[model samples]
Target: MKTIHKKNTTFLNLAAAALMVAALVLGCKPNVSNGGEVQPPVTDGCTITMSAGANGSITASPVIPAGGKVAKGAEITFTATANPGYRVDTWMVTPTKALTADGQQGDAIAKVKVTANTTVNVTFKPIVYTPVAYADLHNHLTTAQPETNGIYYIEITGLTAPDVTGNSIRDSASPLGQILNSNRQKKVALKFGAIAGVTDMSSCFNGCTSLVQVSDIPNSVTDMYSCFKGCTKLEHVPNIPNSVTDMHSCFYGCTKLEHVPNIPDGVTDMYSCFEDCTSLTSVTLKCEYLDGKFHYAFYDCSRLSTGSIKVPADSLDDYKDNADKMKAEAEWFAKDE
Candidate 1:
């Protein structure tokens, strides 16, 4: 019995040796311990690191814990969201390997494979904005007029947000032709984004009789000729910039406007500026009196009595004399406090 067991053990040992020789000849290599025992590669606790660059934030799906460790070959999905006025610029994958939807379309979401220790980085950058020209807006709206937030608005296709630069409307050749004058019957409430370099605003909103509210006048605008003429429903007047020189017929038919801000000193033309403003009661002038320019400036403002026009204290007598000559008896010039 003992001799038979010995033979069986020797046969098993010989068979193992033969198998090892065959494996070596076939170029098959397996990890072996110093004790001559075969072992498999360890795959536990593999990790994927992720980070978000400036102007954005990142999140992982299936909820990687604080340690961020996972089993090898586990799939993780990442979603990057940009801050306001910004967009994802690029996605960086360290030790690049097989990935799914990896930003080829600038998509914010991507799937990552945890092969070895892997790193996924997402970078965000401020979106470069292109200007919207008058012609560009005109072309888009000619076929269809779109409205947003109660405003007849148009945005450039690629821009992430709206930014009105001065160069946008600098090429406008027509100022007195009522650039944005729309049908008087439709109610319009204008809310302007920042406008930097406009100098001529003549008749820009002219004939927009239904215009009720307007905000943000460009500080660089100098000519406001008939800018809001015939806007009978307009009640609030945006502060006029000091760069203006011509306000001829600026608010000629704004019947609902009751108060006027200090008229800038650079104005040289006020002809019919506030004509037919029947509801107007107060006006403050900062500009020096110009002969004949004040004529008909407040022609039909019945509520604007002679004492209601406030003039600079230093120039009160001269403005009064000019007002008398200009036949603005009902809008008599008074010293401003």
Candidate 2:
């Protein structure tokens, strides 16, 4: 009985040892080989790059592969950078209707199948031209008649001296005076004395047939001759200046001139001053030099039938002597009456 018990114990120990060896062998076995080969990580394809220039330039790289398959509902991106002074104008992508970086128009992208590799580029630049300026009346006002036929009352305020040579305020042959002679020109309002050294009204107002009225006369004027001659429509005249030394035919042939203002104290000569003013009724000669020899001065003023003329009381004798000649010249209006 003792021997049998010992043998059973031995068998139990052997079974336990076999179970331990089996467990160790299974635990020590390798699951993989030791060749040291590395596996590559999966990546979705897209790239970006840049170029530069003197003014500016743009560059892009490794475009979307043509028809290259991408998983459905997958997102893809492309990006670029620009140099100094240049601004990105636009961007675009093509083929498969997959996804886009920024909202841009062109081909849409969904699931991409890149049959051929593609590339794209964007461009940039700066600004260019500008403008200039000019003088105001460089070609506006002139002596020539208005191109369109219409009466224009021109006030030459700032223009006292003509820009061209031989054209001064006192000269009749001036460019401004020539403009006044244009028969097509209806009326003009001349404002003098804006410039210096002008002192006469000779041919300035001569041959201006359309002149109806003249307002301010430059006090600087010293001579007054044919200034008011051909101004047949002039009904009223402002007072002559005291600086005037000559009054030769000043108001001659101004047939419509009905009224005359008082002459300034400095006037000396009155040669044919009121010769053809047939509408003048009363004469006021306040001068001391009204001699009977000053004949034909008020010659053809035929409208003086009943109106009294006031000459220097001392010069009444001189006027009474020349009354016959005055009556002879005034016979035209008398016959009309």
Best by lDDT: 1
Which lDDT tens digits does candidate 1 get at residues 230-310? Answer: 778776666889999988888888988877778998899998898998878788888877887877887788877757888
The models' CA-based lDDT, in order, is: 0.67, 0.50
RMSD of each: 20.5, 36.6
lDDT agreement of model 2 with the native:
0.50
- Distance (Å) between predicted and true CA of 155, model 2? 3.1
lDDT of 1 at 55: 89
In candidate 1, clashing pairs total 2
Per-residue C-alpha lDDT of model 2 across residues 13-32, encoded as one tens digit per residue: 99999999999986665543
Candidate 1, after superposition: displacement of residue 308 in Å? 1.0
Q: Which stretches of candidate 2 lie over 4 Å from their true place?
A: 1-151, 159-175, 193-195, 290-293, 324-337
